[model samples]
Target: MAEDLHEIVARALMLDRSAITDDLKYNSIPEWDSVAHMALIAELEAAYDVMLDTDDIVAMSSVGTIREILKKYDVEA
Candidate 1:
């Protein structure tokens, strides 16, 4: 699940795989803005085949938050 999260993070941000992490925050860098946030959510839902609740979406303000939210969905990370 961590690997899956990393994959989603890296692909959504268009970063190198080595650059992906749950600590990578939203808007902490220019590449991770609101648009990227929504896109990332879409990518995660697609990759995991699970729809996120609106609360989950709103809570995903950072990568850490994202990981926590995914865990609530039983993503195992």
Candidate 2:
């Protein structure tokens, strides 16, 4: 599941899987800007088959935070 998360993020951001890390945060890099953040949210929802609420979406500012938010939907990483 961790690998899946990394791949999804990489795909959404047009980044290599190797570029993704636990410390990676939204808007921290060129590829993870606001546009990519929305794309990422869509990817995560599709991949996990879970619809994120606006609060969850807003809280998904980092990889670690994403994991936490997914957990709230019972989508464990």
lDDT: which candidate is best?
A: 2
| Residue 62 in candidate 2, Cα distance off native in Å | 0.5
Off by over 4 Å in 1: 1-3
Tens-digit lDDT string for candidate 1 (1-77): 34567777888989888986767877888878989888888998887778998877877887778877887777864
Give all candidate RMSDs, comma-separated. Answer: 1.8, 1.5
How do the residues 1-77 of candidate 2 rate in per-residue lDDT, one tens digit apiece? 43478888999999999999878998889999988999999999888988999988988999889988898889876
lDDT of 2: 0.89
TM-score of 1: 0.84
Clash list (residue pairs), candidate 2: none
